[model samples]
Target: MNHFQDYTNNRSRLARIDASLFFAPTSCTPLENSVLWIAGCRPSSFIRFAYALSGLDIQFHLTDFLEGKRIGDLTTQQMTKFDELQGETIRKERNLCSRLASLQEDIVDQPFASKIFTSKNYEEEDHHYQFENADEALDEHSQHMAGVMEEADELRMKTLKQIVINILEPVQAVEYLAAAKRMRLCFQQWGKKRDHHHSNKLD
Candidate 1:
């Protein structure tokens, strides 16, 4: 496949999640921006993960703001604040993902390796070819990487607290938290399944 097709295919995946970052024009490729969306995973799964992390209402509308529609439920002040915090959370994640991208350089754009079930030897080796010397790079970027990940995590929590948790009734927040936890499991499983499919594709 041509480089252009690969880029379009990758960007289309992220756009589905509303998780797509300021892309292409950035120093990184589109696939680099979409590290959070593992190859072969459905965009809905990533969206579910994002929804859970943000603690937004089960039916929370992301495209509402993107489409320039005023959020019917939020006051003008509330909508503006939500946009600001939400934007901050997304930026932090994009920053962290980009920082972590280098550690994953070899994972994408490599020829697929066949899964050899005939012998268990492949298991002993890195079948996925991911994260080779990731630690060294992480150590090299340690200072910058550490702060970026921490800021991303903290900002997500802060935004979630302000826009969703703090505004919700105590009982509702508890229920939402429980549901989010369940959704997290689903997201993890979806990621694993996608990874397996990706492995096949590479082969």
Candidate 2:
């Protein structure tokens, strides 16, 4: 029966591939080009601030990622704060993407809802009612999780697309998009293999 493994696997893989595309080379690209990668990130802004503190040199200091230096060694507070700020930056980027291209639209188009609800009908008559109730519960949980993941995926993809477009211009953006699509397809195959492996374990 159609389920996450059968149907929604493709989209989930796409999301991961998108994230990797954006994140993998961002740090090593030329600073000017990388600026586009960090356009709305808190960590980027924080790093910039730190760069300024270090006299705007190309080299970044460890102190930049930290907050204050009251005791000589790096404090957990600094690391945690840096992580939090970075997280906020990602959150804002995702939110902006939602407004810009309606990422939610694509996310909602995934076939998980229909698959989950309809697949339960295949249950034998004796278990049909029981399966129906259980399926409804599963569907509810899946829907909620899918909504969240979909939003996150859209944000990640948009961010990656925007960065690649900025760095490579229109032509390269198209190529990158194509690559991202292929990567997603690969992810689907990977997920199917994994799901099958897990299913075998259960059997």
Candidate 3:
């Protein structure tokens, strides 16, 4: 019951933070800019994010399990099962990462910029690039990127759900999810403070 209550409270707090993220300002703050650069403003980053979260989760779980064992709340058998699940999860995430990378490479190989550059007209050392069909090519690229992003996001959600449902007890799942949310919220708050501090320094 206490665990459930902690999960519920954390879940509510996370929900509020999520809402704030959704309504966050359009203009990129310093932190947002860095995130965009690292994430490449792409949906494929979802897989990477999931992989990172899983790593953190595994670390936390291992620490907790060690403590539980000391307190006689967890058994070696449970730890063994967790080890197997963790291995499987890492393998799956790596496969997905490889597949996404390949798809992104395919998209990049046939860039719209190439199409526009190849259509360049030159006369007497004067050159002008023709963008004929460039828009159409760009649109196609956008569609492909959107599709990949959607696929990545779906996989991320599915993987997380599977980990929670299959590998964790109900209470443990809730607590793990709550902790993940709290981590994200802390990062968000910290980023905002960092940005504010920088802005004040510039003033």
Candidate 4:
């Protein structure tokens, strides 16, 4: 095996070797680039998303993420008003994600539905008849979660934009997006390592 240093005189070939080991998240995903895409999500959109989403880690509750509450005048009055108008949809979205993504089932996560679809009570097979539409239910619930997540992303960006306009000076605000992107990358890498370590332990 030739050492990489052997390619020092061949700068182009050395760069190729270095790049082969590197994975860039900025480029569009193959699924995103497909001409006849079936997933309905556009490739360019996913490219922008994958590159920038980590910049704003907005969860369901706007205030719960990234000290988001401090960004603007997002108040209890606003939340209460939102609930009064679109509370049910928001509730369903939160409920669905909590149930689907949770390792343990929670009653708070199940409001309109009963315990039948809850994964935690699998031992209670007596309720199997109730979840006859388990597959369909899970899919519908998951869509709700996705919708909420997308909305949260919009709100996060909106909040950040306002912060840049109001709170920060012209210079610092300009650098925020790039800084957020780097922070996100670091967080994602650490999360991957942690998950890998946990999986190894399980094995």
Candidate 5:
């Protein structure tokens, strides 16, 4: 895969949960701008919580093995292992929704409340209201990030098509060509709608 496609694929997976953050509660601790909740063993399995964090204006930190100690810390082989663990966690969570009800309740209720109560500082030097307009700024920043991602997706598609042309083997080249064509159709159809929806939210 070309750089853009690979990046876009990864980014798309992350972006899928962008809407979940809407229901997340704000942080109560003034020093900590975000909270990291690790509900599953895999990175993707933690996506819902991540989105929840995003929606709340909190940065979601993945604690799965795949997430590791730092960004780019996991090798491809290690990530594959983490991915398997995450898959298992997701399956169990899906099947045992009732069993995990209390955990979910606590996450949504108590932790959220505490995070907000303790982190409500919006004061500025000389007693000014620095955060009075925070919500509006956040909305604008979200829109800007969404636009950047859209541009990245477009570039990814173009790069992938270029790679498809460079494949020398007839069979391999045909396969990539077909894949590239499908990606193009999917992007052309969904790209504008997605971008517009996100754009309108900032206004």
Candidate 6:
């Protein structure tokens, strides 16, 4: 129950942050913008996020064992159930990925009218490519992609919530959530530093 409350509070905080970032992007630092980009400017790759969480889970278990702590310990049955959930989640993610790939193919395979002119009478214009009804086609495709990506993001959150609320104990869930947040923050910071380093090298 406490974890759920914390989640709700965090969601509200994030909503405010998102609003601020969108409405006043100039006020945000370059590192903040870069972190947001690294975190996915459009739809995030939920599968990759899930894998990272799985790695964290392993590390958490190993850490607990090393510290001889009884807290945040999962039983054999819980572990088995988590494995099943992971498999199911991956299957759903794969379907979403396939849909995205198909949409990409549709755009890539689309045929456009093209012409080439070699004559000097053409005002030096050499080539032209015309895509009829491209706007409508692209708008529809974008809508479809948005819907699929929204569904995927929702699924990702739902799965994480289920794991924290339904599968893990309250204490364990709290610890896991904290660790996950830390990991995400660390990743963002590291990504920002790496981008800065690369930019300096390019200069």
- The model with the greater TM-score, 4 or 6, is 6
Cα miss at 57, model 1 (Å)?
9.6
Q: Which model is ahead, 1 or 2, in terms of TM-score?
A: 1
Q: What would the per-residue lDDT of candidate 2 be over residues 83-175, giving only the tens digit for each residue? A: 554466567755655553443353344443444356556666665532234444445544544454555444444444333433334543444
List pairs with backbone clashes in candidate 4.
32-43
- lDDT by candidate, in order shown: 0.44, 0.42, 0.48, 0.39, 0.39, 0.53
Where's the lowest-lDDT run of ten residues in candidate 1?
109-118
Runs of candidate 6 with Cα error greater than 4 angstroms are 1-71, 111-124, 128-133
Point out where model 4 deviates above 4 Å: 1-131, 199-203
How well is each residue in 81-173 modelled by candidate 6, as lDDT tens digits? Answer: 677777787777678778877866876554311212224324535454332445555557656655554555456567776676777778766
The candidate that achieves the highest lDDT relative to the unseen native structure: 6
Clashes of each: 1, 0, 0, 1, 13, 0
- Please provide TM-scores, in order, for all candidate models, with all chains considered together: 0.38, 0.28, 0.54, 0.34, 0.25, 0.62
Best by TM-score: 6
**Stretches of candidate 1 above 4 Å error?**
1-81, 91-138, 192-203
Across 65-142, the per-residue lDDT of candidate 5 in tens digits comes to 212222223335434544554465456445444433443454446434444444244444555433333444345444
Q: Candidate 2: list runs displaced more than 4 Å.
A: 1-161
**Given candidate 2, what's the lDDT at residue 154?**
45
- Candidate 3 vs candidate 6: the lDDT winner is 6
TM-score order of candidates, top first: 6, 3, 1, 4, 2, 5
TM-score of 3: 0.54
Against the true structure, candidate 2 has what lDDT?
Answer: 0.42
The lowest-lDDT stretch of 10 consecutive residues in candidate 2 is: 65-74
Q: Quote the positional error of residue 117 for candidate 6 in Å.
A: 14
What is the Cα-based TM-score of model 5?
0.25
> lDDT by residue for model 3 over 93-173, one digit each (tens)?
566567657755764576644654453533335555545565565556445444444444444455465545664567656
